[model samples]
Target: MEEAEAEEQQRFSHRQRLKAAVHYTVGCLCQEVALDKQVQFSKQTIAAISEVTFRQCENFAKDLEMFARHAKRSTVTTEDVKLLARRSNSLLKYITEKNEEIAQLNLERKAKKKRKPEDENRDFMELDADVVGSDS
Candidate 1:
């Protein structure tokens, strides 16, 4: 149907946009590194690096998808992400630490869930004040 074709076209367009954004970000990072090293990079070199980074990101996504599917889950979970990071010990450790931090934060949030509405509003006000203070 025409709708299906249109949806496919939209998906392809979104992908191209994502690729462009990633390419631009990779180029900027490469430029920064090259400057720090007092070296110049050619267009080809930047393009190559961007391509590799983009490919790696795509592979990581596919891997997470497969990991979730293998676990018989419709959504990717933290365990799936941890499995993906298993190739690098440091990454796994970092993720584990981050997960612990998130868990602690969740516990804190749940403990605060029974607080009065006024307390929650005050918390938001405090957060806003902090943001404003930091902007000065």
Candidate 2:
């Protein structure tokens, strides 16, 4: 009986940690937004949003973990996040567009780095040739 009670206590402690991990600032932000809109948000309303946001975050993390497991990967990639966002068409489109934009930016940066050294070497060679010809 004591072992069972100890197990229960451990479970409760774990749950407390999990709940603590989720911040309640989202609820405060919601209340602020309600004030801006001239809508009075009660404590209950803030609590509800906080609970819902925490559940949503928990669900998303679970889904991402499932995707990672399905892919036989220990780490979740951006693809896993995109797959999770696939439930909403607008969200999927936005993620896709943003991913493309990031890829383009990375490619541009690589190209710029590659060009800089080659251009500098070419300029140096031209300067060397001009100096040699002038000495003649």
Candidate 3:
């Protein structure tokens, strides 16, 4: 169908754009000076860097998918990501810190929501209704 073809084209275009962005970022970083000396990367070096980075990203994605599937999960969780980063101690540590930070933030937000003025008003209204009904 034309719709399927269009969707496939869009996906291909999106992938190409992502690859180009990766290439550009790698090129920019490669040009940065190191140890007071300017650095330069040949086209082949840039291409190789981009290729390896992209391949790793793809492998990570697949691993995440498999991890989720193995757990019968429809969506990936932080545990899955942490497992994926198990090969790198620093990365795993960083991910654990971030996960804890986010968890703390979520708990604070939930507590704030539960303490809203409207919640107090609703409870008072319910209590008042029960008292009035009993009197009647």
In order, candidate lDDTs are 0.91, 0.86, 0.92
Best-matching candidate per TM-score: 1
Q: Which residue pairs clash within candidate 2?
A: none
Question: Tens-digit lDDT track for model 3 on 1-136?
Answer: 9999999999999999999999998877777743237556789998999989988998999999999999999899999999999999999999999999999999999998978978899899999999999999
lDDT of 2 by residue, 32-83 (tens): 7887997877777776776777799879999999999999999998899899
Q: Which candidate gets the maximum lDDT versus the true structure?
A: 3
Better of 1 and 3 by TM-score: 1
> How badly does each model clash, as a count of residue pairs?
0, 0, 0
Q: What is the TM-score of each candidate against the true structure?
A: 0.78, 0.72, 0.77
Candidate 2 backbone overlaps, count: 0
